[model samples]
Target: MTQPVTLSVPCPDRDCALSLARAAVAGRLAACANIYGPVTSVFTWNDAVEEEDEHVLTLKTVAARVDELATLLQTRHPYDVPAITWETCSADDDTLTWLADETR
Candidate 1:
């Protein structure tokens, strides 16, 4: 049984987020991608404090394809060091089935 996962990524803007989302879904690297907009993020970068409004992209896929999805994000993301994170997810059987089929 393949494990489901949710990947979290922050993009500079809506366009970038949408582009990544489209690419992931089009390539079947992810079953779906949810875009959340213009959220304020404050963090430290290069020893400096920075704050920005960014879009968040949430990608859903199975564990087997995570490496490929990550590679896609890493190569296409604009940041010098993009933050890519994911967690294993629990879902009902039907949802899992749909996810697996979409990704496959």
Candidate 2:
């Protein structure tokens, strides 16, 4: 059975996050988006681990629309190197059905 995919994007600020989220949902590239700000991230970059404060957005959508989501995210991202990652989910059938319906 096909399931919803979860896409995570790190944003430099709230405005960029909101724009990306709205575009994804309006374009039917994402079934839903959850945006949160003021996240503390500690990760590696340029061969070193670093810490930063950023906004995070998680987009839920069907697997088939992942490429669309990627393109939209990359284009709208504020970061020179945006952190946009996707993972297939194992979620309840009902939830997945709703996502499919709403995205259309």
| Residues 1-104, model 2: lDDT tens digits | 55789999899888888899999999988888998878999988889999988899999998889988898889878777797899998888889888888777
In angstroms, give how far residue 52 of model 2 lies from its true place: 2.3
Q: Give the best candidate by TM-score.
A: 1
**Candidate 2 lDDT:** 0.87
Clashing pairs for model 2 are none
All candidates: TM-score: 0.97, 0.87
Report lDDT per candidate: 0.95, 0.87
Query: Where is model 1 poorest over a 10-residue stretch in terms of lDDT?
Result: 89-98
Give the lowest summed-lDDT range of ten residues in model 2: 75-84
CA lDDT, candidate 1, residue 30: 97
Estimate the overall C-alpha local distance difference test score of candidate 1.
Answer: 0.95
lDDT of 1 by residue, 1-104 (tens): 86999999999999999999999999999999999988999999989999999999999999999999999999999998889999998988998998899998
Task: Please list the residue runs of candidate 1 whose C-alpha ends up more than 4 Å from where it truly belongs after superposition.
Answer: none
* Clash-forming residue pairs, model 1: none
